[model samples]
Target: MTETLAETTPHSDEPIPAYPMPRASGCPFDPPPAAQALHDELPVAKVRMWDGSTPWLVTRYGDGRALLADPRVSSQSTLPGFPHPNAGFRENAERRRSFIAMDDPEHARIRRMVTAPFAIKRVEALRPSIQKITDELIDGMLAGPNSADLVSALALPLPSLVICTLLGVPYEDHEFFQEKSSLMINRYSSAEDMIGASDALTDYLDELIGVKLAEPADDMLSELATRVGSGELTRREAASMGVLLLIAGHETTANMIALGTVALLENPDQLAVLRETDDPKVVAKAVEELLRYLTIVHNGRGRVALEDIEVGDATIRAGDGIIIYTGTGNRDPELFPEPDRLDIGRDARRHMAFGFGVHQCLGQPLARVELQVVYGTLYRRIPTLRLATGAGQLPYKHDGLVYGVYELPVTWDA
Candidate 1:
C-alpha cells in the first residue's frame, strides 16, 4: 500500500541538499562531485526543489534506469507533485503541456504521429544534405577570421537550419524561435515572463499550423496538419509538439556540438582519436563516449510516483516526486568503471545520455547522424583547430536548463 509523505519521507535536522548541485570548477565535463558522493552512499535520497518541496532523487545507475522505465512512475505534468526541473518549467508547464509530458497511451499515440519524419530511413536520407551544409558552414567559418565563436558560426545555425528544413519552419524565423526558447530555458525566469513567452510561441506555431493546413506541403508540419484535419489532435496540442521539436531538435544538439568540440580540444588524445579515424564505427563510438562523458541535459528527469515503489533502500511512496539524476547515473562507477575518464574507444552504447525505455529521445537518430558528421569531419578537416581563449575563461552555462558553453571561441590554421 502507498504511504503518506509524512510517514515515508525521511527527515532529519540537516537541511536537504539542493538539486542540480554545484559541479567542481574546471571540471565542467564531469558530474557534480556532491551528486557522485550521493551515488556511493545514499543513491536514493531526498532533495529540495525550487518550490521548497522535497523529492526523491535517484542517483545510482541501476535504480535510475529501473525507475525511469517503471509504469508506476508518471510523466504527466498535471500530477500534483511532479518535480519540475526549474521555476520556469514549473511556471509554464500547465498552460503548455506537450505530448512528452503525457502518460503511456496518450504519449504513444501522439509521439507516433511525428515518428515517420525521424525514422532511420527518413533521417538517413538527410545525411547528404547534412554533410553539404556542414561543409558549407565550415567553409564559411574558415573563409572568415581565423578566430571565431563556433556557437554562432556553426553550432547554433547547423541544427536550426537542418531541423527547419525537416519541419518546414521558416529559416527566417530562427532568431525569434531562438529568443523564445532562451526565455523558456532560463531557469531563473519568472513564471509571468516564461508563460508569456511560451504562449506567444504557441500562438506563432498555431498560425503556422493553419498555413500548413491551407497549403499542405511535404514536411512535418503538414503531417501535423493532416492529424489536425482528421481531428486526431487539437490545434494547440499539435502546435505544442511543434514548439517542443523546434526547441529540442536544435538547442540540445547545438549544445552537444559546441560542448563536444570543446571537450575534444581539452583532451587532444581523444581529439586525435577522432582526427585519425576513417571508420564510421569509431566515429559513432566516440560520439557515444562524448554523450556519456558530458550528459549535458544535466537537469534531472522529473516524474511523480503513482504507487509505492522501492528504489535502493528507500520506499518512494505514492504521490512522491522523483528526480532521476542521469548525469550522476552515467558517472556510476558500477556501470562505467573508472567512470570519470572519457575514452572514445570504449563501448558506451549502453549510456543513458538519450535516456532509457519508452521516453528516450525521439530525435536521437538525427542527433547521432549530426554528431557523427561533425566529430568525424571537423578536427580532421582542420587538424590545427584549438581554443582561441583559455578553456578556463570560456563561459559555461551554469544557470541555463541545459548545460553547455555559451560561446566557444575557436581558432585554426590557414
Candidate 2:
C-alpha cells in the first residue's frame, strides 16, 4: 500500500519550514542558509509551499538525482500535486505546454525536432564564430568607457546574438523579447503579467514562423516551419517550441555569464586559475566547476510524485509534491568535499546545475561552448579585469527564475 502524506511526516510536532528560504545578505553565491541546514539535518523532509501545501523537499545530492531520474516522479506541472515555484507559475502551468514540463514519447518527439542544432558536434563547430562574437563584444567594451556594466556589455548580448542568429530572429528586437522573457520568468509576476508575456512571445514567434515558412532560412525556426507545413506539428506546437528555445536559449546563459563573472571576481584566486590556464581541457573543467558553484537555476526543480517512492528515509506518496533543491544538492558534502569552496580543479561534472534525467537542459552543449569562449577569451585579452564596485553592493536577481546579477559593473586597465 502507498504511504499517504501524513504517514511520511517524520516529525508531526515540528512546524514545516516555508519553502524557498532567502539567502543571507552578504553570501550571494551561497545557497540559502536555511536550505543548507535542512539538507544537513534532514536530506529529505516536508516543507510548506505558498499555497499551504506541504511537499517533500529533497536536498541531498544522491536523493535529488534518484528522484529526478525516477519515472514515478513527473515534471508535468499541470498535475494536481505538482509544486509550482510561485503563484504565477501555478496559474499559467496548464496553458503553457513547453516540453520541459512533459514526459517521454511526446517530449522526445518534440525535442528531437530541435536537437540537431544543439548537438555537441554542431555547437563545437560554432566555436570559431562564438570566439569571434566574444572578441567583437569585448572589443566594443574596451572601446567604450573603462567602466561598463558587464551584464549589458557582454553577458546579455553575446548569448542574445547567438540565439537570434540560430533562430533567424532579428537581434534588433532583443529589447522587446528580453523584456517579455524576463517578466515570464520573474517569480513575483502576477498571473496576468505572466500570461501577457507568454501571449506576446507566442504571437511574435507565430509571425516569425510565418516569415520562415514563406522565405525559408537556414535556421531552427525554418526547420520548425517546415515541420508545421508538413503537418508534423501544429502551428501552436511549433510556436511553443520556438518560444521555449528563444527564452531558454538566451536567458539562462545570459544569467550564467553574469553570475559566473561575479563569482570569479569575488574569488580572484579562482579567476587566476582560469587566466593562467591555456589548455582547452582545463578551461572546460573550470566551466563545469563554475556551473556547479553557481547553479543559475537557484530555485528548486519542481515535480509531482506519480506513485509511492521511498527516497532517503522518507516515503513520497502518490500525488505528493517534490521540490529538488539543486543548489543545496550541488553543495552536499557527500558529493563534493569542501562543498562550499570554489575549486576550479575539482571533478565537478556530476553537478545537477543543468538538471538531470530526460528533461535535462537541451541547450547545455551550446551553453558550455559559449561560456568556454567567453571565460577563455575575456580574461586573456584583458588580464586586469576586475569588478568596478564591491561585491556586496552588486544587485542580484533574487526575484527571477535564474539567479544572476542585474548589473555587473566591471573594469579593466587600459
Best by lDDT: 2
Mind giving the per-residue lDDT tens digits that candidate 2 earns over 114-179? 999988889999999989999999999999878899999999999999999999999999999999
List model 1 lDDT by residue over 279-370, tens digit each.
Answer: 99999999998999999888878889999998766989999999888898887676678888888988888889888868999999999999
Clashing pairs in 1: none
What's the TM-score of each model vs. the native? 0.96, 0.96
Stretches of candidate 2 off by over 4 Å are: 1-9
* Over 4 Å off, model 1: 1-13
Candidate 1 local Cα displacement, residue 144, angstroms: 0.7
RMSD in order of candidates: 3.1, 2.8
Note the clash tally of each candidate.
0, 0
